[model samples]
Target: MRAIIQQFGPALESIALEHYTPASLSSSQIQLKMRFSTMNPSDLITISGAYRSRISLPFIPGFEGVGIVHQCNEQDSAFSIGDRVLPIGSAGAWQSYRNIDERWCFTVPNQLSDEQAATSYINPMTAWLMLSERLQIQQNMTVLINAANSAIGLMLVRMLNHLGIKPIAIVRRDNTLQEFEGCKLQRIININNRDDYHSLIKMKHHIKVDAILDCIGGGESLMLSSLLKEHGQFINYGLLSAQPIPPQFWLERPDINFSYFHLRQWIHSAEKIDIQNKLNEVMQLVYKGIADTKISARFSLKDIHSALNYIQTNEETKKGKILLTF
Candidate 1:
């Protein structure tokens, strides 16, 4: 079987394709023939050794993928030879085949294409949990989203619209405003311009920000916190800027509630049945075109270096997710 291995060092230099033999499955495990996986920011971060504590060395690097059941242990009655499933939670998804426990895999909805199902789990689920579960946002309320041009950001905007809530997309560039062309929203703020802050402050008087979905931490987070209505909630999910929320910022925001969310932690804490139910709800929305991912590009496993380069160079301008096909 061919796999992308992260030997050591930076993403491009450390990652390479190599042949390897997959271990025989245990009685509760099933073998998956990988169809497609995505190149998420976390994957690159893991390869760069930033997530060294969670990831062991010399391992296959992908976190999620859609695959067909090629071989299954006879005792594993939950899966069959031809089922299309998402083998999530475990690493080593950037390979031709993977042997995973049957319990960890979920059947993909027929309404979703292979490409859509391949990139499903992480981003959509994160958006769903934040809006529906974590914050429990009600209709007619206004919410602010930082990094609103990202894949997850786009999903959040769509989800907010579906629930009849107002979305305030805060972006860094003027060109990003073009991406939200057809989406209904309260306002789009380009914080790159100093004048925009003055406009934002004035708008806050009429529009009470109920919550803030912040992906970029540091100064940007502090800025968003200031915009929140009294007792408003702020959920920080990503540190795209690689900066932490300063201690002083948290200390001063006594009227605002702040919390952090991580998908892995949520998955680990929830029951399997609960996770599946949430996934079903999100997928149903996706089937209706309410919440969906945009595909930026696709690459074969051999061309992973090119894919990494594209993500690195076009991080700001890329419109959607990047996939890796086996």
Candidate 2:
């Protein structure tokens, strides 16, 4: 089997494609023939040693992917040979094959294409959980979201529109405004202009936001929090700015409720049946074209370096997800 391994050193220098023998599966495990995986910011962060405490050396870097059941033990009744499934919550998805515990895999729906199933878990699930579980968003309520052009942000917009909730999308660039062309319930606020922050404050009169979904931390997070209704929630999931929020920012906003979301922590706490149900609901939305995965580009495993470079250089204009096809 071929795999992308992070040996030691910087992200670009450490990553290398090599052959390895996959281990035999235990009674509780099943072997997966990887079909496709995604190049997420988290995957790159891990490779760059930013997540050193959680990952050891010489480890494979992908976090999620879609696969076919190449082999399965008889005792594992949940899966069978030739089953199309998603290997969830396990590392080494960047490889051609993986042996994962049966509990970690979920059968993919026939309605979805390999591209959809391949990029399933992270963005969609995160958006669903943030809207349904964390904020408990209700119809007619207004929700504020930063990084509104991101994959997760777009998912949130569609879901909110379906539920009759209004979404205020804050973006850094003017060109991104075109992405929300048909979204009736969406209000695009460009933060690039100094006056847009005041525009948001003015919007508070017409749109009483119940929660603010913030992925861009640092000054942007603090500025977005100011627009939230009194006692409204501020959920932070990513640090795109790579800068920590100053302690004074929190100290200043005593009335606004702030929380952090980590998908792994939520998965660990929720029941498997509940997780499956949520995923199924999102999958149905995906099938209906309500929740869609937009692919900006695709690359082979051998071209991992170029793929990473594309994402790093075109951070602003890259409007969709990047996939790695095996």
Which lDDT value does model 1 have at 312?
85
Model 1 poorest 10 in a row by lDDT: 1-10
lDDT of 1 by residue, 194-293 (tens): 7877788787677778899999998888877777888998999999889998786777788888889999999888888998999898888778776777
Q: Against the hidden reference, what TM-scores do the models get?
A: 0.95, 0.93
Give me the runs in candidate 1 sitting further than 4 Å from their true place.
4-6, 315-317
Q: Could you tally the backbone clashes for each prediction?
A: 0, 0
lDDT of each candidate versus the true structure = 0.83, 0.80
Error of 2 at 120 (Å): 1.4
How much does candidate 2 score in TM-score?
0.93
